[model samples]
Target: MGRTFIAQRGQTKSTNDRQFRRDRQTPEVRYSIENAVEIFIHAKEAEGLRKSTIKGYHDTVRYFRDWLSHDIGYIDEITSTLIRNYINYLKNDRLPYQGDEQREKTKKGLSVFTINIRLRNLKAIFRFLVDEGIINKNPTGNIPLVKDDEHEEVQGLADAEIDMILGSYDDKQFAQWRDKTLVLLLLDTGLRINEAMSLTVDNVGFQQNTLIVPSEIAKNRKHREIPISREISKRLRQLVDETEQYFGEGSRIFMNAYGDDFTADAFRKRLNRLKKKLDIPKLHPHMLRHTFARNYILNGGDVFTLQKILDHADIQTTRKYIQMDSEHLRQQHNKFSPVRRLFNRKGKRL
Candidate 1:
């Protein structure tokens, strides 16, 4: 006789019951992790995220998948515990893959700021999944960002340093004059390097003495007009005329020797060359921006206005520049102290 299969507790001798046992033995596959990542990327692209932002999301997920060794195929296999372990891995085991130099320098792992960026990207992916009803719970929900040094003094170039950089360029050479004009514009308006490079002749309002940073090129994707000084306006007009005469009427204000758009990387490399030539090791593009912010705050410009000028979405970011103007703060305190004023009025020596 054939061996008998007896039903245990909560079991029945029916065809449906037998099928249920089989189902328990082999769980259903909902979605693979790769498929989920693809879906998330498509959704983000549909939502009008920038290509760079989408690339960040894809890269973060790709790194996470690589860490899993490709064994954990299903999205359901991911858990809070696994994510915590991954965080630990980032803290202890992960090494920077930038280059041999970076790998040797950061053998301890990535910096807290970089790790936080990856964490944020991963969190965004899982949050999207939960919001779309693809996942019931977010694995990264309970995770918190690693703390960074917020009070570290902001580095802005000194007046002498700025003078040195500005004086180093020659006005006679086409490239040199263009670079000098670029530096002056950066200092005057505090525009990000990319935004400044994207400017065209029409973007400048010569009569209004303002620069119109359009929504397409603005970092925050919001349009705003920045008031430019008469000096800067003149310099910009000269650049436009020079560019037009040389390149035969191009829209872009800044162009490479080949009459192509000047890229941020090219600007960075130029700064690197200047840094070596001037022996100002800290000379870089963003330093010019920081110098602008510091000077703006010192010259009695309010943080609220600075926020708009710099296109900072948060007032808190603009407020940091206020802290950087400690010398200015001291001068204001010395000039306006009520006790000092009262003593002066009374002719008291103290």
Candidate 2:
């Protein structure tokens, strides 16, 4: 669908008539950002995003729809001022998509981190529109991302807190084994909830003690083999045997009470409830993933190796979780006393 505009001709009656006649046939409408968004959705689906990620983009687009209803539908109408207002709206107003705060009766206000994630997706949407010639330029190009401090504390379960949560689980409940195993698997392997839930019994190799994730199941649709520790292997073997007794071949290894694969939301809710019950704060799935990365890097794991293990598309993304190692910090502190080094300095005599 192309839009045409009649160019004004100064003191030219004949040219005006010709342009007006041409304009009548072609509808004078701006590019629809809404339609561009739909195209973006189709494009993302074609890229083969996991079902959960596609659902998230769908929800983000749904919110964008609400945002459009308040703003205008045309891509050309998306001025910088409008984007500023939308950013402020997300920061101040409670979003419809976020879950209700457990403490408060009202919906939880959006966090800076959460806002940036949606904004990043929004950036991708407009960038795609511009590249596809759906729009002449991206309106979001000039919009600044919400900045955040690099040293900001990540929310996750500490070692002690994880122990407490694990301690609180009932060993007798079949669900407990499933849930606990899932958490441990995430911490051990850094697998996303969807990836972990997609695992089948055949993915595990008892002899080699390795978990081979196929390309189709991975987030980036790339396969890699991850080593499994004896502890994780033992737990998985028990869980697999029990699960197989009830479920036949080709069925998912993990299942909820309803015999369905665990959705990410359901897993989160269960984890949050466990945290509340255990009086452990800020426990989540990605937290376990974070804990895995942090500990792995601190314990001398290589960055390049970590990137492959985490299945990060870029090495820079892997670097975020790699903080200064404790040993490195200690060595730096020891080297800070230059006076002691000078006094006892063993260098070649000048």
Candidate 3:
């Protein structure tokens, strides 16, 4: 073969080209906090986090970036002491975003709960950076969540309140009927407002008497079937049928007058109008969910079952519903007090 040269096993034209490129390429410059946040957001999106969750991450970081005079030098420049100073700023100096007129008018500084949420979001970002080897030290490692001193028992709507709210909606009107069904659905299922709103006709299972909260809409991103009562099933069926008939065969169960999806903001505005008309100031969507959880516990439903129904990741979160049902606990204690039962038995023997 006239002295044929053999190619090395590990060497190829492509490999040599890659090696040359690697040698000539400049090392990656340290990322600024702004750059890191953008990368972090993309990472979260790739991980399939909800838009709302990703927006929260962006908002929290944006506040920090603004606090640093919009020039967060580099990711590594973020330190525990700097984070503590930001916490102090959140506690004392940071005002509610001017975008929310209600919050701006009502609040001066961030609530402990709000501050803690921002801290947790920041911690998540830094933790992600550490895991990706973007930063060696996490600035939020030593930071503790702001302690909420005013933790109060969860308050759910009473029977009278729920009845009044339900009665306010006229079944004759499509919008009214839809809102009433939504309220009933929230109360019956303990579904988050967004989850309930995102539901479509396909999510309803009249034959099975269940509502399927798809993994995409669910906060925990777990697919779960919530059993529905006959009343709710009927209402859902009617809502679905009417929505299709009126809105021209859209998949969304709830629709605006223009046949578009009923957005959360629109629902809130409707609730605000209802609040004025019905004189129920606390009439909000989440309150219905709270009502469901508390009533479920009070009506002798187990915490374990309630946890699944509410899609709570932690049993501790479900236990709070039990703790909030203090009146129910007291009634049970009164009915089954061991000391009282013992005394009664002794008297009978005597």
C-alpha local distance difference test of each model: 0.83, 0.76, 0.82
Better of 1 and 3 by TM-score: 1
lDDT tens digits, residue span 281-334, model 1: 577788778788888977878878889999998988876654454665678888
Worst 10 residues of 1 by lDDT: 20-29
How far in Å is the alpha carbon of 90 misplaced in model 3?
1.0
The prediction achieving the highest lDDT against the true structure is 1
Model 2: residues with Cα > 4 Å off, grouped in runs: 1-33, 46-54, 69-71, 95-109, 150-156, 298-300, 323-350
- Against the true structure, whose TM-score is highest? 1
Clashes (N, CA, C under 3 Å) per candidate:
0, 0, 0
Candidate RMSDs in Å, in order, are: 6.9, 6.9, 8.1
Model 3 RMSD in Å is: 8.1
Comparing 1 with 2 on TM-score, the higher-scoring candidate is 1
User: Candidate 3 at residue 36, lDDT?
Assistant: 82
Residue-level lDDT of model 3, residues 1-350, one tens digit each, is: 13333478764334455555655443356888778888989988998788889889988887788787545588888889999998998888777775776657555678888898899999999998887777877889987888866676567877777778888888888788888888888889998888888988788899899999999888888999999999899888888887788777756887887789998888888987888887875777777788899888777788889999999999988776654546666888877898778778844652
